[model samples]
Target chain A: MSDLSPAALSPGGTIGILGGGQLGRMIALAAGPLGLDCHVFCPDPDSPAFRVAARHTVAEYTDTEALKAFAESVDVVTYEFENVPAETLELIAPHAPIRPGAKSLAVSQDRLSERRFLAEIGVPTAAHARVDGEDDIVAGLETTGAPAILKTRRFGYDGKGQTTVRDASDAERAFAAIGGQPAILEERIDFRIECSVVVARSEDGQAVVYDIAENRHENHILKISRVPADIEPRTAQEAAEIGIKTADALGHVGVVAVELFVVGSGDDERLIANEIAPRVHNSGHWTQDGTAASQFENHVRAVAGWPLVAPHRHFDVEMENLIGHDVDRWPDLVAEAGAHLHLYGKRDVRPGRKMGHVNRVRPRER
Target chain B: MSDLSPAALSPGGTIGILGGGQLGRMIALAAGPLGLDCHVFCPDPDSPAFRVAARHTVAEYTDTEALKAFAESVDVVTYEFENVPAETLELIAPHAPIRPGAKSLAVSQDRLSERRFLAEIGVPTAAHARVDGEDDIVAGLETTGAPAILKTRRFGYDGKGQTTVRDASDAERAFAAIGGQPAILEERIDFRIECSVVVARSEDGQAVVYDIAENRHENHILKISRVPADIEPRTAQEAAEIGIKTADALGHVGVVAVELFVVGSGDDERLIANEIAPRVHNSGHWTQDGTAASQFENHVRAVAGWPLVAPHRHFDVEMENLIGHDVDRWPDLVAEAGAHLHLYGKRDVRPGRKMGHVNRVRPRER
Candidate 1:
């Protein structure tokens, strides 16, 4: 367990943030209110974080010179995403303290490594096997059986690099669909609900998990997340316990999201690890308006070596993603009363793009 | 009551803001999430609002060219403060839609006008009279009685521009202290608690008020505000009714705050309108975390010719302003469990300055 006190980080301290997307932009927004100045380094000149940040570096992540300069500019570094290149992490590690560390990213970024690591730690996960080529895929399929997912080992998100192998006829198609890259084949586990546990861990090993969030997906894109997930109290507690242990196993400092599949029914809806997001996540968006401390702020605190906030649910919250054209409904949402709307300062809203979200909170009856 | 619907406006519309302080900065923050860009025209280049605003014009309020250019840049103009210069308002009015209108500003900018306007609308207010000179002051004092407060008709706030005429001996000092400006003398009402009502109105005359907020001030600067104010249910209802009527009387649009004195005791502690703020206000800061719709967002919604959100409070909340050196406690506040902290990106922290605030919320008890 890591043991870091959030109170040690004072106002006027500099926070180094990698990835300048809307998540990073929101993190910077949350950091501003704590008197913490943010230095955002992103390859894109149009990164929304740059608009409000105190300082921004527009250079590729792997550029050593730019990375070094960025590392030296801040007291600590935290990335908004896990896919940052390993070499970039090495270049930054020596200059400023990097959290959720390079090691955690190394495992989580690759599916093969993440599965092996989770299995080694005795965590319940899908039955799986790694495949490198056509022959390997066939052998793995024999062991994992049909009705499974074949996913590329790295750089896949939003269902972009995976295919479902329903039967023998689909095996070759699934393999070719993924371009036969180094991949992982896992037996699909039928589940009752797709839920996520978002936990923030400090260096001192203290962990806090927000209420499990029930997620609904559309075309592999997260469309909505509702807090107070429809699960028994015991199930929720067990999910949080798994989250705490996972953070500890990774030696994680900052927020980590564990995606889980709840199998069976009633008292037997056992949760199995699906994937890990080593940063503030979409599932936790409800915290922005429904909790005492937003996930972004807590993540910032964890990376900045501050105390962890006690995650709390202030209301039964439903958060819906405004994907592309859905954003056109901003006028209606704004007037919907009791809806907290957050739009990323993205210029163009294309199809499947996450432009904003609306959080509707229903207070408990008084 | 003015009536307007948000569907009447299009995206890329402009919102003219009056004050460029943190409240304006926050309003701009909220506006960005809804696809509405902000054009902040303030006298200070270092105004916090300038940091994140899409467009900003640094010019004196009295500069007609600057005000007109500012108005031309946006579809609608709203203000962060109520004391905008009347001449400046006239300059901007013709070029763009101005919310809460020039008349609302005229009423709020002067103490006598606000009281008279409230009184005319059947709203209860403290006894007040115009004080043009020493003779008027002497006669007004005799009629309004001793221990009354003498305040400037314009440019006064946070206990500034006012003196308490405790007796005959304090009359000359009170008169000289205000620099003999156009002033108003008011008989101070005895009150149990200082409370405020925050309301938003669309152009079409629809109005919505948040629950009454109880305020505590120290040295004229707001120190704390608690929502779900420990007031009677009828008192809260009356406060909202008063706010709606005030907005109707002024034909106001956008968010307006009415500060009131809860006079008398218990059941008899009726509400007396203190003053009106024709913009997003400090008293409603708790909405940032405790309510589904923050006051900043609601203000933008109303002025954008959109439907106003009737956001409900998620928790019973208390907001404490971090003033001057109090901001140094950010680390401690962030470390405290369940504390939602916000700091303005103000570079300097001077005494009595509002650096930021923290909201602590608890679930509403059944």
Candidate 2:
């Protein structure tokens, strides 16, 4: 086993966070209460996380001088997004320890590598084939068949850099739609629902999984997430096991969210791994109000090398995303009795942008 | 009704906070999720709240130019502490609305006035007499008797500015101990325990109170607060009712905590109002982890003129303050299961200084 006794961060230590989006803002907020300070590093001058952090550096991710200065200032390094460049990590790795590690980042950064890694760990995934050129797309189509998804291997999110193929004729068009990047064609699963398990693993390989979250998507963007997904206890247990196994396989020392597609009905229900997020996920936002400890706090704890607490749902919760114009309803939502609103301090509300979320929780039945 | 239709602040509006201590830091944190931005105003350059606020003004409270600029930058003004100078409020009152109002601040700032106001509203309090000189102190002792507590009428907190008089001859020594400031001599009550009710009131006079909290103090400083105070149902209800009444009486527009002393036994148990804090109290920190909505959020809602939510406790929570050296235990505390730690980003841990707090929550008994 890897050395379990990693150097734990002291209470007054500074945590270096990359990517100052909503996730980073929330993480910085969580770290404050634990006596840990945060230094947010993001390219955007108006990044939301900068408002809540003790210190921040605005520079390109690949700026070696800035990266080295930031790494030297903090006791440990963590990221809110998995898309951080490999070179950036390389430059800072020697200066500070990065939780969830470079390995987890490498796997999640590319669709092809993520699938291959999952398969190697014996985690069942959608039928997928790597696509490199026109010939590879044709061969990939022959293997995965029609009604498959063609997604760029890297830098794709919220349905960007992806397209659906219906037949052989659509293969070339799909490849062109994804900017002709190195890609993976995945067979679309006939599933009943989408769910995710967010787990946190400590340096010692100890892991704790939160309740499964049922997710709903609109235009390929997450719209809502409900906790205690309407699945059998056995299925839920299996999903948790998968999350823990994946986290262990990665040797990740922070939160990892494993999204899965649930197929079939009742006794035949099973989960197919879809993707892994190497940081806090939107689907786990309900934990902020419905559980004793939040996913953000757990992620902070893991990176700080503290023991993990398996948070249990104290309430049945529904978390609805306020995407773009959806945030205009903040007035009414704030007046709602059980609605807990959380808005990221973003200046503009472009279409499909994630502005905030509201969690409504009810006491769970005994 | 004093025009109950004051303009309510909309989301994205700026909130000007007068203190930049831990309380202000927490308030700023709570405001962020509600789509509101904070501009902390404090003289301390190292104020903890400055780290989280979107904007801040580091100038003396008496600086009219700075106060006016701060007032003009925000839609509403509020304070985390009651000690904000009257001149400072007057300078900013025309520029922005101040929640909890000047009346609440005027009363709570003086021990003599607070007691008189409570009596005016028919809220029972310890027998008290104002003392402006040695002659008044002698007369006050005659009326309140020995074992009375002599406290300054202004700026007293956490046991400072007060002394216990053991006998009539000890009055002069006790009075001198408190800097001979204008003070009040209060008859100390023989009580079983101390409890507090934290309530939030909106501009429209709508109010909501959280569950009562039982408090324990050391060296006159609050050390622990446990929710669902071990009291009779009727007593708890009565305490809550008194809190609402006090809030209404002061025309308070935000969170107000009324600390009470419990006397008698069983069915005969009753509470005597001891003090009224016009801002968030230390006792309500448990709500951060144990309730659907925290006191900080509710206070923000009230000051922002949003609808109030009467939060119910989901867990039995015990909040312990980390004073001075107590914060050194953070390494162990963060590893403890069910313990949620919150540290104010304060750099110094001077003796008796409030550095942070830990909330330990468990499933509440049905």
Candidate 3:
């Protein structure tokens, strides 16, 4: 792959975005001020990303003709999510460059592979084993022990496609729950807190990482994320190091979020790699208002072959996601002084849906 | 005019934007998020707004058929600037709803008329007199005196179409320079500071104002704006009142800005209405990143007939315009973590041109 100068690309160049969700919508929004045009491709007509894009193709990712047309029109291709198919990437790649490349998709698409890839790169992860059938499940439980999680190898998100195995007796039920798909069983390592580092890398290898973020989840959905993450500076540094190493290993370009479990006793803080999101993650939403350059803008910059902008913290920040009925509080949120509210312009507020978020900068005590 | 609820508008509904500039592009940008289409009617195809808008009519404002076609296709019409022609308003009025309506434009388009309207409504304004031509110039100066400003009644902006009549002889030259057009002579009252209030009102008569903005200008162009303008509580209240009263008098149904000059000494702080902008003003640009609800969103809400969102400030914000070559520092601005850089996506960087801006939020010091 080759790198292009930012100025050479100019503002009129088109960037292709896959997955027309709020993330894609935000990427398009961020791209606007940079003088870049975005073309969003998604099967759904109601995709939020479609609203802001200069052009959109309403076709399945598997539709090669439409995909070819989209790729030809754009200077480069990027995605808003990690679930992009290898074939879709292969189709787009021959026409225009795809960033965070297919290698990232291959590694992140499957749980077993991602863990194996992490271990191969000398990144610490939980003890894990693959389970193909009932017999394999028994062996995996024996090796990884009980109190481990059994997750399907692909298409799992927000705690979906996974089952918790607390005891040996839960093996069959867990196996049956996942419909006996190819799965991975990992030891449920105890961790004091869940933290993530959002890092962006340009094609030329320059990388920038935001401050570590501490995240809280409810029912497998993110609830709140605080930046500068109430953690030791060493832990934050290590988390960023892990993120950079992971990005380098995957030859990733564009923004990627690496979720980590900060574990162990005092003076022994260690981070275990949990997952690598090849695109901007929900936990990094704080960047929109709390930091100088947002993850969205940085992602656009990276994919456009621009220089990586160093992220800075404007204030200690807290971001809360508005889930389901939470969106109804927009009026109240709007009235609250010093609260930055962002609605995705999503009409349907279904259960577990991400409607919007609010970032409040905590004023430093004088 | 009748109001249309958010639910009443659909994806294909055309929105007619009155001016062809960066603000129109931004409004068009926001319109896409709501799934509403945009049709920009401006005489300049080279208009920056044309790049992002879906459709455009590049015809003279006086082209009745062009305006009619534009108005007929759109559900509602809004404007980027307050200087629309009376005939242009008449051309579209019977066809579609024009928001921040024609009445507001009539008052704001002419300096003398705006002052008269404000003064008639018992709103405080600097002492002034109308000057029809060079003959009345002397007498008008006699009433307002030296150090007054001689300004053409219409088509003036960024200090253009006007001159400072510092003395009697200067007043004569100023009158001749304006080609003796009808103009306004106003006493250049000493002001402590320049500030503006941005307010949005719905057709249902609900209105909300953002924090008072203290502004600084260089060469007639806004240079920087700070929110939570260091002012007494009473002055802030008065500023909001001025905005509300101005909006009400204009029968405005969209975002409006009331720029005022703070005069007088301690314990007697007084506000003198300077001008009315029937569209979003440059002083409100900080709201995009520093407020809970952006002025753009509020304007959309107002024109869409939705409930106006209450404006909320997130941080003490300073917005600095990236005028002309100032945008050359975008790399540094982008690298500065706390600065939110917004480039207008304009192609050229002419002197005195508003290329973009950066909003920096400083930590609230104790």
Q: Largest TM-score belongs to which candidate?
A: 2
Q: Which segments of model 2 are wrong by more than 4 Å?
A: A1-6, B1-6
DockQ for each candidate?
0.35, 0.49, 0.23
lDDT of each residue in B330-352, candidate 3, tens digit only: 65666575677777777788999
Candidate No. with top lDDT = 2
Query: Candidate 2's residue-wise lDDT over B1-366, tens digit each?
Result: 122234777667889999999999999989887878899999999999988888899999999999999999999999999999999999999999998899999999988889889888888998888989877877887788777999999999998898998877887798899999999998989989999999999888888899999999999899999987889999999999999999999899999999999998798899999999999999999999888789999999888888877787788999999999998887677767788889997888899999999999887873
Error of 1 at B105 (Å): 0.8
Error of 2 at A242 (Å): 1.4
TM-score of each: 0.91, 0.96, 0.83
User: Top DockQ: which candidate number?
Assistant: 2
**If you assessed candidate 2 against the hidden native complex, which CAPRI class would it receive?**
medium
Q: Output the better candidate (1/3) by TM-score.
A: 1
How much is A254 displaced in model 1, in angstroms? 1.5
- Residue pairs of candidate 2 with colliding backbone atoms: A33-B342, A33-B343
lDDT of 2 at A194: 96
TM-score of chain A of each: 0.96, 0.97, 0.96
Query: Candidate 1 iRMS, in Å?
Result: 5.0
Grade the docking of candidate 1: acceptable
Name the 10 consecutive residues with the lowest summed lDDT in model 3 chain A: A1-10
The DockQ-based order of candidates, best leading, equals: 2, 1, 3
